[model samples]
Target chain A: MTSPSNSSREAIAHIAFDDLVALLEAIFVKAGTAPGVAAILARNCASAERDGSKSHGLFRVPGYLSTLASGWVDGKAEPVVEDVAAAFVRVDARNGFAQPALAAGTPLLLEKVKACGIALLAVRQSHHFGALWPDVEPFARQGFVALSFVNSFACVVPIGGSKPVYGTNPIAFAAPRAGGDPIVFDQAASALANGDVRIAAREGRSLPPGSGVDRTGAPTTDPKAILDGGALLPFGGYKGAALAMMVEILAAALTGGQFSFEVDWSAHPGAETPKTGQLLIVIDPDAGAGRSFVDRVETLVGRIADAGQERLPGDRRYALRRRAAEIGIPIAPALLKELSALAGAPTD
Target chain B: MTSPSNSSREAIAHIAFDDLVALLEAIFVKAGTAPGVAAILARNCASAERDGSKSHGLFRVPGYLSTLASGWVDGKAEPVVEDVAAAFVRVDARNGFAQPALAAGTPLLLEKVKACGIALLAVRQSHHFGALWPDVEPFARQGFVALSFVNSFACVVPIGGSKPVYGTNPIAFAAPRAGGDPIVFDQAASALANGDVRIAAREGRSLPPGSGVDRTGAPTTDPKAILDGGALLPFGGYKGAALAMMVEILAAALTGGQFSFEVDWSAHPGAETPKTGQLLIVIDPDAGAGRSFVDRVETLVGRIADAGQERLPGDRRYALRRRAAEIGIPIAPALLKELSALAGAPTD
Candidate 1:
């Protein structure tokens, strides 16, 4: 097939998955990331791609690495654990990349879930981390429920209003049960994933109908026009818009971070900077409500499964992750080349 | 104007809000909610109407009265505080009506928020309450950020799934800052609120496009068909479905209450009794993040307000409530008569 861009190039590269990881790590190391920060970020990047999330994959790694190189994001900055209570904590990211900040803060959330039943972490001053599913999985693995949301520079409109006043705030929910995998929900409150729209534009494809609107507030199917002047439309109309606002309040208001109409998410040209804020919360099933919570969750999953349903919500991803371990990480040929060059590593 | 089917009765009974409240209180007392419990449940009814949520108003009194008369919901069930930690509590509604149950549980949530910084209350095995906005208002008035979600019996289908698997979950988020009234968000993850569909069906009104489909899996503007054969559509296609599912997973799955597909919401003849669930979260703005949280919130609100044109959510309701309190709760003659007759109180 011909390239979607008018200026087409056939110089697509191929590199191994491990090579890419090494490359990302090298880039982060160059940017002052501590010993293992790059690996974590790379793993997140790979996991996102494997899960079919294209926008949040290796395409974002360079942006992340750039942010680290820029003083805007401290690759080696430690997330300051300022306030800690039974079920709440505040973490100052110290202008760090979100990957490490999130890595250091996730356990605190899980610990709170274990000790006190539920815990909430307000994360301020961090760059955009990869997909949210990977961030919430650790809690789900520990028989706990997890939820997270992030507020980026405003690019979405609030419901009933045409102007952009909020980010396409994303919300993720993970449920833990005694049987079967916990259902994990990760969604951006938009008509389609923002990444999908970007991919469509890059590939010169029309967006799904009603997915976005042009600058004149008229709906359009062209991705480029939608991205240039128009704002992303919220999913399910008002409900999605309201949800985006809820996420803003929870992520920005709760975290004491930049908020709607005040934050910036675009990558700075020739500068490595990130403009987003996030919040994480975890709930232990075995705590407050006791075993009943687990039993009830299991029962809930059972009924849904029993009703002759196809598959549970998070089952496919869990199955895919296990498969990845068996067959090694699945990286596209082009992504493999990028990672190889980043790492200068030998490939099979 | 021509009369709606709702106005079909030429000499419909009029009811005063206070008289109606008294009648509800009496009915609750007779059923078993005891003096204090009865009063709380009655208050919710009046509050719902005051907030202009007529769908959850007097129309529900008779149904609730019947539920109390029946043994399905324990009107006198005395919701007990099962566990309480620093900023979290779990309450067993004991199958009581949610109004009193929520009333009983909210103070605990607020108390925990004061003690531990943030608070969460999971109320399980409760009957349907009114609009979620009123439930959060009390907490919002106290200058705390409050969020709540109620999961009813599953009346909708999971996105991309073949069969029905979730409920018409309603979630509300309210925040209080120094300057403005609380920014209240009371919304359901459905194309149309349940009551609107029901009312439209009763009055023979056509649903808007994309709202629903007929039972044959085909799109239709007929409300009755949508309710009968078709399931209610989620707000943003899949995201709304995920949200409603997420709320159910939290409110019911985490609370150890019946899942949506298991319980019944509508009080249609021959239907099983209603057993619902709710989740409440409260955050103290001044605690960990200091005034910064409030400041950031105010800033965000201000930006939105100044963005060409867009009213802050809940502003209209706050204005209405203020005016109503200053003037009086207006009651239609028919409702006033009904309330007066039921309470044996003379109408003005």
Candidate 2:
């Protein structure tokens, strides 16, 4: 199925899940990534599509290639996990993609969590260009509560400040359920995520009030002004700013990686692999509190649902994932052509 | 110094730090609390006053005594700390006051955190009548990052719903700084704390827009509408609601205590000791990372300060504490008289 574009751009095309993953794998393999790393990266990109996050799907392949071409990211680098303590795992990502690094260390970290009741995975020198949920949702599926934080290149201003001092630091959390799916949520500390505002600016649409500031720090609803020189405001004034600081400390300081202010962002937009840090925490609910934990969670969830407040965190993503699995993932025809060219294949 | 009331109300009184603590202790003892529990409870009350949180200070004493009088709380109950896991301490409060329960468990939790890199202190069946910061600040002072969440009587509506389905759940966090006071903050998930809105309604003052809704589920700025029949709105819309759910799960579900909706709030104003749950997490930064943690935190804090955002999370509390310690705490004359009567003493 395809929808013609109003502009001269190519129409959208629907692609099967396996086909999308295979195409992405070919692209990264051609771009000098090891076959295994390419497979992991492809799965991460395909999952973003499956979960309806088009911004992080195959559209981002060009940016990943840009970072790989510039040597800012080591395509074949392997992550190393060291047990710094009984309940801590330090993962040096070796300047590679964060998804693969986390994929490598999660099982090891979960083992420690089961043994110690709680565990922390401190990931350093990784480039996290994907959504935060993918890194933490796996543990929740395996009957554990997981929370993660990551610090990116500086884009958001601190409260009562004009300049960008912190990244649009995001936090993700997931809690396991007894029989149903786990509850999971991921949110940036800013009023809107950077990519979202950029999409608004690209579509020539203005933003809601309090979204960001103009170059002179005057509040503006123009998304272009924010994307250009201004900074995104924190989500809930001082409260969200405090959370951003918490993310900075937990993801950067505790992970022993570069802080947001320490990053040197480019004048022009090109994904040079912001060498960032992330921290993930996992707790075995069975170990921490036993069977009573899941029962209690189900009780609260039932109350929330019975009250007709069923749109809990991560509900939208879950719905979209089911829809995408039944149907196929939608990608623009121009994007498919670009991927095919990158993989050295003719257009379908 | 006191301000004369327009209605011929009693003027305020200034009580010395030690005198305030002694007065509270006598009242708790008269209310049938054990000597040691009374001492701990009194210090908790005095510290609230010392930090200028007058709402939680002597103002809450009547509620505590009422709970004790009603036999809803076991005034002399001693908390038992059980080593639930390698990194978890489960404190059964024996249906007693939370301050004493926390007092009994803090050292044990801190020791586990120092050894395990992170530890969780779960308090169950405790009446947490005071502020949450006090429960976490001690560990921060001892060079640990502490976070605490407590679920209270239901007063706040979940986002998109008109009824009170959740507590004005408060979460507190503190991160230690080298040679400086810890950065600390405590915030209620509701748009405003329940007591704060009640004080406003008592004073016949209007509230900010979007604070709460009237009985019919229509948004209203009238404080009385909210205090009487309406429900407080969650802070920052759905984000605050998610945080509230996080607190409910962490403090209640994980701690094996009652959720907010499960509480039967009293019809009268006096507190009947809502047996709630609280979760405290402490992490030794030195154990997690190294010396680099402090330096990185300072770097980020300095940037925040340089941007004129120096009024960090805990600065106001720290300032109030220094001033109160040097001078004395201010109390309303009416409240002091009431407290004196409860303690079987004449006015000072």
Q: Compose the digit string of candidate 2's lDDT tens values, residues B193-288.
A: 778788898898999887898877678899999977788888777888888888888888888778988876464344556687888877777755
DockQ scores for all predicted structures: 0.47, 0.58
TM-score of model 1 relative to the true fold? 0.89
Which residues of candidate 1, in runs, are more than 4 Å off?
A1-20, A264-268, A271-273, A288-291, A305-311, A332-334, A346-348, B1-33, B161-163, B213-219, B264-273, B346-348
User: How well does candidate 2 score on lDDT at residue A308?
Assistant: 52
lDDT of 1 at A80: 77
Model 2, runs deviating above 4 Å: A1-12, A266-269, B1-13, B265-270, B346-348
Q: Count residue pairs with overlapping backbones in model 1.
A: 23
Instruction: Give the clashing pairs for model 2.
Output: none
User: Per-residue CA lDDT of candidate 2, range A77-148, in tens?
Assistant: 899887777777888888888888888888788778887788888888888888888887888888888889
In the order shown, the candidates' Cα RMSDs to the true structure are 4.9, 3.2
